[model samples]
Target: MGHVPTRLLSHPCATRSPPMKERKAIESWLTDMDGVLVHEGEPVPGAPEFVNRMKESGKPFLILTNNSIYTPRDLQARLYRMGFDVDENSIWTAALATAQFLADQRPGGTAYVIGEAGLTTAMHAAGYILTEFEPDYVVLGETRTYSFEAITKAIRLISAGSRFICTNPDATGPSNEGLLPAAGSVAAMISQATGVKPYFVGKPNPMMMRSALNAIGAHSETTAMIGDRMDTDVLCGLEAGLETILVLTGISSRLESETYPYRPSRIINSVADLIDEI
Candidate 1:
């Protein structure tokens, strides 16, 4: 919605580095959907080219999104609506990863969800029974209609000793207007109610990264996790033993990197810069 920050490209960090070292075997890329490729529903600059270049080069890639609110089909349609030609199978959300984990842990068990239809649908499709009754697991994600009643129910089940699992830890997502509560907000509420920490299974979590790599059939050594969020995207890549590339076109600022222990393997201003480098 605003001008693309120029400092992201011409920042002091860029001058010190002799251009990004050539991309290491990056045969496959695991990319974040929201901030890395698009923002507030619009493709970031050079996003189409970046994706098309990968397609042209015959390198495989998948959109690894932490947002569990949307399914692969939903995301594919959204990308198409945004003018990007993306394959549906190339999309993987925290919802899918979380569902896979839950299915393995407690197959067919009832799950109490505090998120959107996508989370519920994925879990159900994965053979987990969806119920508002006392569930074995209380899963949390992005629920736009996250009301007091929903939180109350989730807290009740969690306090009753149900295993609490969160899709992600992101507190906010960008909008055309401003930032809004994300999946992590619901997770925080449940944690306060249950006095227990949730097992996060999204970006920054190796499980999510592992699932993406497995789906793309790429080795961690040859995989790249590209995103704009430092705490989630870059950190997840670092955890997965993959190369972490930080694009400043979204939430994180260059100065903020000094505060986190999760240092990115490389930092670029935007996906456009990545295109420029390639």
Candidate 2:
């Protein structure tokens, strides 16, 4: 299992590599983590095999997540416990994308961040100073505890000329008890108070996909994006010029997908349907 599938390679005699036209249309993959692979702390049916097949195909791939509360290593451990085998380097988060974006825009910048270790650590690695005194940006990300004081501070900082930036535009996040106010909901409040709109840096914004492509050294033309939602995942993949494959294991239903102005390249029942293609 650790080696590339034998069929992919050409044997000197009887067995030959697939002809150019017979080769997989997709050369690389970028897939959403939550709905496509797991749901409610459980691995989706055939999700683990799909991931393993992608790895065995000897293709470049990365697992993407909008949740910024956990770092790549943390998520890797979480997924490992849940039965998925993936390296930490194969994981990508909104926090990492946001940090990459900020680093490109202003290298050695300062920010007043309100989030957990994921966001703060990414900022630090990008050489961004986490401060409240005339910072360059007011960065916001997912957090288990969103204090009023932090929101108030972010509001004040944005009011005084700091640019507003959010990890993703999700208004609410899922929880065991119920829906919890996420970064987007708090961003709405801060925007209402200060009249400053935030620049979102996650799915539904193609920049994040582009960054992921660059991170994996893949080209959009040959890369395929596997996601479950038509709104964010599929839409972003479309905008990023990659082939989008939407699965029905999560949010968007086949009936719901018809309503979107743009459509995914293909829609399938689950990742199980895609294992052979990889």
Candidate 3:
């Protein structure tokens, strides 16, 4: 969240340097916190070192994620508790992105959200009205408990031509036990019930980039999207016109990379490798 640019001189033998040529010009980075930075509430391998490097360099970066269950404050505390010191404003969730989009598109419209209070609060704060009475849109995300009443209400609203807005399309996230169902699971069911596709506002969608750039004052040429998932993170950056780096840590393995639809600008073993490269 902090935006402080400090000067650093590259070695004389370095491949490139300022004034002579652009040294990649990576001014801002957008990264996923979970899986990439931490796994099971613990900092992932080399995460601490990578973050420390950023701090030392005074580089501007933000942690972005599709998980909408927690607020910025919640994530900030959790990361601090796990020994990763990050500013709360550096975290951007799908919920916040979706809410911001909705506010700009249809301010004060009613939303039938299928997520947690974090999402609801964001929507309301953004001038969106939360209601089950003939909602203007159906906002979908992960829900721990999908009650019969909730399904019925959403289906009823969907049948009435309420626009569907999905947070992210992730089907699962890693856990200590195993992979658990993610926000996209609920989005899939709702799409099936209403026979309507949703306007996704998470990864692979350019709106995420729009919001992230607005927050950090970065442009496509000067920003890098570093992530583990090619389908979402890498694709989002490519589609949004930003440089992308794929890391082999988290959800994507080497086998998965070969089958990815698009290729990343660069590939690294982890965020730590990014520190070495950039």
Candidate 4:
């Protein structure tokens, strides 16, 4: 990914403002998962309390993630193990957003998918059929293991007529071994083969943020997005017309974030700093 053009961010579809003078009290919260709350399966400092505060306040909130490999229930269980009592409904993934977008575009559509249970299950729940036969879409999502045969099939289907969709634009994912090839990497190969780039429905696209907001009946004016990355998290929040908070606990550093065309509404050390905000 490259630096976003300033004009593109200024499109009238959504509002992206410079740092605010005084803002409305945040009545709703949308926070990123990996960096803002947990990191490498462990809860970030003050993350659990922040989550508890959200729950206790009875305010609308959702934990967002680009990882489309695990279902919301699966993630909720994982968070519970780490002492964050987040409900499944309070978790949002790129898989859910992609599925929601597809369902809205073409109800009961058929798709050829290359992903794990998270993506497959969302597609199923959205009334989408999984097939190799003339699918309406060739959906790409995160998988623990990528199959050559599936990639070939996706390429062929896309070339033949299926529209291509990817869960996220992240080119790589973290692992115990360091980094691993992710959906975006595979999507690139498929796009190269078919000469058709995929439409991504994850962070930075604003669809993910908007879907979460809609799920909680949140209006942008009263909501705030807490994230750790300037690219995905902050961009998505800003485009969705939410106040954006950038934390330093993840991929983006204070210095690194300065390079982006737009700045987050505020920058803090971590979610710990926002506990009082709740």
Cα lDDT for residue 65, candidate 1: 85
Give the higher-TM-score candidate: 2 or 4: 4
Candidates' RMSD to native = 9.7, 11.4, 10.4, 8.0
Q: TM-score for all predictions? A: 0.86, 0.91, 0.86, 0.92
Residue 64, model 3: Cα distance from true site in angstroms = 0.7
Clashes by residue pair, model 1: 204-236
User: Which should have the higher lDDT, number 1 or number 2?
Assistant: 2
Q: What is the lDDT of candidate 2?
A: 0.93
Model 3 root-mean-square deviation: 10.4
What lDDT tens digits, residue by residue, belong to model 2 across residues 1-278? 58865665655444755553332478999999999999989999999999899889889999999999999999999999888999999999999999999999999999999999999999999999999999999999999999999999999999999999999999999989989999899899999999999999999999999999999999998999999999899999999999999999999999999998999888999999988988
Q: Which stretches of candidate 4 lie over 4 Å from their true place?
A: 1-21
Residue 139's lDDT in candidate 3: 90
Regions of candidate 3 where Cα sits further than 4 Å from its true position: 1-24, 276-278
lDDT of 4 by residue, 1-278 (tens): 99988988888654755653687899999999998899888999999999999999999999999889999999999999999988899999999999999999999999999999999999999999999999999999999989999999999999999999999999999999999999889999998999999999998899999999999999999999999999999999999999999999888999999899999998999988888877
- Give all candidates' CA lDDT scores: 0.83, 0.93, 0.81, 0.93
Which stretch of 10 consecutive residues in model 1 shows the poorest summed lDDT? 14-23
- Backbone collision tally, model 4: 0
